[model samples]
Target: MAYDIKDVRTAMDPVDNQYHIVLIIILISLIIAAGISVLFTGGQGPGETLNLSGSLVEQDSTGQKEDPAETWIVRILWVDDQNRTYSFQDYPQDTKPDPKSYTFTGDPPPGAQAAMIRFLSWDGSTERTQGARYIMDPDSVTAVLNRYTLMARLSPLPTTTPVTTNTPAPSGTPIPGMLIPESGVVCRNADGSCTARFGYTSRHDHPVSLPVSDMNRFYPGEPDRGQPVVFMPGIHHDVFSVTYPGDATNLVWFLMDKQVSVGTVPRVNTSIMIEPISGYAPLEVRFSERSTGSVPNNPLAGTWNLGDGTITSITGPFYHRYEYPGRYTVSYTVSNACSQARDSGVVTVYQASYTWDTDPKNPATVRFSCTSTGDPSVWFWDFGDGYTSWEQNPVHTYQRAGTYQVGLTISGQHGKGSVVHTISVPS
Candidate 1:
């Protein structure tokens, strides 16, 4: 039933041909209009236009000229109603130097839910990033972002829009039904053999030694944006939060790649030695400082307060002679960038006198008595007969008469003393 062209044309006539031509022209016009609509509107379906604008600036010493250079990069993320995320990056033009603010145009896809935006500082070798999240409003078309441009060295970026539609902005009180880091086996290694090895610098640049391998070791598996967990070695970093509905985990991002300080606080031990703890006038004493606890060396850099009103900026085994009989306190203080500590000791100086007598009843027997003028805290006697005694008075009987050298040493709160005498005995 296929008809030849000539037969078909004869049956149509001029009136039919003109009608078909008009229909063809109308169809072509409709197709062209649809293409134009898609080109201008990005083929969006039933949603408002999204206008995202922000500014980035390089850091200067004077806090002026906060604008990004031409080579910087910006990345933006958009989440649709289906929870599908779309990413746009490689926007070098947005970082033109010394220009007006940078802006992005987006057609909020039908059923769009949330959005996130971040800027990157790139030097063709390394990149620093700053990001913030927001709850997409189907009714609003404008979103604004403002924050410090540098990472780790500056403040966090701030967004004007809300992160969620139902939740009000954080006020004075905790929000109702707000989810926090969950508590379902935050760490692995059930046997408790795992050890904490890593540490990070906090926002204030203070080093926090982690008690575990990392914050994620407590988690059952890998970490995500929405897990309620507390930092170990106790909460030392800036609190940063992230929630990816796609992953369903709240990941904390406080390990902000900061420089950690090395070394430890310094500790010192002060020691004093006096030849005679109790003696006459003009007693000589020695003071020494020994570093006990430090990584490599002591961090203290302050002076030594001799406690006798003599402050010297010297780390010493220092010597001093006391001219008068009295009690003196010695101390040393050391300080460095990390911390400071002080150690002290005491020295006493006094007069001492002692004498011994022998028993005439038995020349081989000797009874020694301390007639010391100073009240000695302690007394020692060397009989020179192969015997020693700590008592103030001692009696010794020699097996045979012989020549002997007897010595007595005494110490008290004031000072120290020593006396030696020669004795002869006959059998």
Candidate 2:
């Protein structure tokens, strides 16, 4: 029988209260289950973001986006192998489908309506780039998004931090004063090949000469000869070392090979000095007075006594000046930079300038005093008594006296000097 609203109300009184309550509870539980299922199963399907890049094609021949077919709505209809359908809801980062990479974040609750995504295309940032596009699981959308965001943090803005890289400097120890040009290689073009010969400055400071092209060819690469390298000729040599002896410092320019570009002038830093130069190792001069019993006014020839560095004759400056009638001094200084040097000598003893006037009209032979610079000192003296002696200093009596001229000559490693005097005798 069809129950009217009045009858249903009447029947409700007969229904058990427990049964109705139970029914209510069961209904509520079913609803909750359904809700849970929907929440967990939900995924990206509708309202999901879409990214597309590249120029849109137009129905018209113009191929420009201005055409109606290239509009946003028209672009969303992507045709695939299956021809499935999907649409775009939002295009973030402004221009849709920009070449920029995209990432998804936190997914919707499970058991909810899912969003479907279809990748349209992507455009490259520049001519060098290859654009990309693809779809991924929306359930994992959140994690992917977080990953991209972390990466985007790295996507530098137009401005970026500058990077610093260190470059080592080109340096080496300067070559010490060159005593002579380093050994040089010279190539001899013989027949069809070349032979290299290494040569050095003279044993005793000499000049060198060679060609330039041959020098360049032989060095760095041992020439056809294979053993010798070539060198530029005419390089002034410096014997000085980069550092002094006993110096712990090792300072030298290490060339790939021995070859140095000596063509250009180089500054000198090493020092070389003449330690010592001896002209007259041991020298002596002697003057003797003739035993005429004539009684020579002055003592004859004084002993030179070169006396190792002690002899004032060449001790230094006054060397040439003093008792010069016997011997003189000579001094000099030499440097290594160049042959240029300084030297000086003066007549220390001016015997001729001295006065000698001893009287007794008659006398025998006479002598004078003087020392020479040569290994074997030679004494050439003019006695006031009209006579001369080889002895450094000699005393003599005038064989026959009248007016007499006296003089002495002395020579040494420092050069030579002489002195003379005038003597008068009367009966």
TM-score of every model?
0.26, 0.18
lDDT of each: 0.47, 0.32
- Tell me how candidate 1 scores on lDDT: 0.47
Candidate RMSDs in Å, in order, are 21.3, 32.4
Cα lDDT tens digits, model 2, 105-199, are: 32322222223332222222111112333344543432332221111011111212122212111122212332233442222122322222233
Candidate 2 runs further than 4 Å off: 1-265, 268-376, 384-386, 399-401, 412-415
Query: lDDT tens digits, residues 1-427, model 1?
Result: 7999999889879788899999999999999999998997665544333233532233456645543332444444333434322322223332332222445543433453224444555544434554333345422312211111111211112333322212111122222222112211111123422211232211211112322234333233344434223322111222332212223232232222212222222233334344444454567766666644343322346466655677787665667777765777776666543345576766666655455566778778788888765687798988887889998888888888889998988877655677788888788
Off by over 4 Å in 1: 1-95, 99-199, 202-271, 276-283, 289-305, 323-325, 331-345, 349-427
Residue 45's C-alpha lDDT in candidate 1?
47
